[model samples]
Target: MSWSIKNWRRNQILQREGIPDYIWQKLISMRCLKGLNPDELMRLRECATLFLHDKQINGAHELEITDEMRASIALQACILILNLDLDYYRNWVEIIVYPGEFILDYDYADEFGVVHHIHRIAAGEAWSAGPVILSWQDTIHTATRSGHNVVIHEFAHKIDMLHEGANGCPELHANMSAYTWHEVFSQAYAQFCHQVDKRQETIIDPYAAESPAEFFAVLSEVFFELPLITQQHFPSVYEQLALFYRQDPAQRWR
Candidate 1:
């Protein structure tokens, strides 16, 4: 059957009903939902239905993944789909959750073939064609409007990867001019790097300087979290992001 707002409420990710009021309240209160409005909420709910229907969410470690947990994650994750589409997340199948901040082991090789031990802490990750991993602790606190959402960031990566590997460039709509995207983004990315090298604070996070992909993800977070601020500081980058995401968040969020 075709997915639509008309039939969305009739569907649920889980058949086990009795969803708590608090869960609904949290979802309803989310800023991302606000951009959707009441009518759009219905469509977003349908996208959530599809997300829950297709994706398998797993609770890693000792975490007890509850209905609320799934619902909360689905509600926000699907909003990107509400505007874009489900195929945006084509590569991943699971939303793995660790109870708290999980440790990731990294190995670095030297000229002498010596391996260096490296550990890193992350709130969430978007693997290429792999499942998205997130920390429940960070996930729970990551309010949709805070300009720092792991789900949106990871999903944005998925969108960026659709064209090829996420070099911060995605398949833009036909109406969009490619050269404008390149001109704006190149200037902004370069300026952002210069500031980062000087250890200077920027309106857009300097973490964006880490890589083109990271710039996309970090700016994506700020796009929704602080759309007004992002547009104000980096209007060029903001326009490009608005074009790619297909949403005028600076306007909607305002």
Candidate 2:
């Protein structure tokens, strides 16, 4: 429907049931929401409320999902889509939260057709047209730490999967060029991988060198957390992300 209809519905719902003071306090304490203006904050709250209405933030591993936890997760997830719309996340409906890192055991075949079973631990995962799973511990650590945010990382994958698969590129705006995104990200990813190979100290996460898709997801964490560093290190990618996400987080932090 239209923006006005969505806004009116959100307002009506918010009027009846609003965010609690304690939950808002926890969100402010996280520091990521610090520089948002009053209007932005209000919109964020509205977005978060609609998120709660649309998606299920359920706790796994017998972990009790509290209202505070729901609000906190919604606040973080909504921040990424503040300038975008809820429609961007249309495919996802469930957010599974675990107490800590979880393990997944699966089997895969090699080129020789040899079957191998492996177990891997993951902090968060976003399956195309499926749920976004996260670890509550890692999610909380993002508030105090730099260069980390599983929520943003996984959500970035969802954004990347919008057009197709998560291939380091999200659906670019009319102003953004596919050639520019490819040229910039390819060069930066190669350079970062070189630095990682040499075991040099780097500002961006070394895990970013894993693949183009992971690079995109990891840089998304840095884009929201250490905006200055991301901009300073990879100016072109930062510009593209700023254009796509439609937020100058560096300016917000400043």
Candidate 3:
């Protein structure tokens, strides 16, 4: 089926179910979505409905999944793909929600061929072609205007994974230049790492220094939540992200 036809069919099916007004109200309460036009808001609602239908969103550890909770998560996740489509998220079929932080067993090999195992606490995680696990506590707390959002951060990693692995570079549009992406992000990441080493209190999270992939995800959080800081600190990276996401959050807020 054509893209338009598929989308229309999805919309038709969703119209029968009908998203609750409270869901839309809760979504607009989010700072990132405050200034969206009516038309854009409608599209976002449709996309979110499609996301909820296609993905299995389950609450873990005896936590009950509320309609509000699902709507909030689905709204946030679908926002990233407003200009794109559900196909971007085809690799994942489930969104598991925990009450709080979750633990993951980490295994690694040493130079002497030794192996080690460790447990790492995480707010959210996204595996290549696997489910996305998140902490509902963190998700609700992270919806502020501050530059922190596990939903956006993990989804950004999924986007990066679309082109090979999550290496800070997702597939670019025809007009975007990969050379520019590499040059700009390389310079920005190095500088950010240097600042982190210097013990500077930076607005961008220090966790971004972990890896190139992490740098991209962390910056994506900033792009949507605190777009002004992103535009001021690394305008080129923000420009690239705006082009990729097809949204100008700073302008919307302004």
Give the total clashing residue pairs for model 3.
0
lDDT of 3: 0.87
User: Across residues 1-254, which tens digit of lDDT does each residue of candidate 3 receive?
Assistant: 69999778877879865569967775677765767888888888888888888888898999999888888888888888988878889867999999999999988675588999968999999988898999999998985537889998998888889997789999999989999999999999999999999999887989999999999999988888888889998898999899989999889878
Q: What is model 1's C-alpha RMSD?
A: 4.3
**Local distance difference test, candidate 1:** 0.76
| Runs of candidate 1 exceeding 4 Å displacement | 1-22, 106-118, 144-146
Worst 10 residues of 3 by lDDT: 26-35
lDDT of each: 0.76, 0.87, 0.87
TM-score of each: 0.84, 0.91, 0.92
Model 2: per-residue lDDT, tens digit, 21-119? 778866865655768888999888888888888899888989999988888888888788999998888966999999999997878675599999979
For candidate 1, write residues 11-117 as lDDT tens digits.
Answer: 54433343345777767676656665777776666667667777888988878888788988888677666777888778668889898878878785755999999
Clash-forming residue pairs, model 3? none
* Model 2 TM-score, all chains together: 0.91
TM-score of candidate 3 against the unseen true structure: 0.92
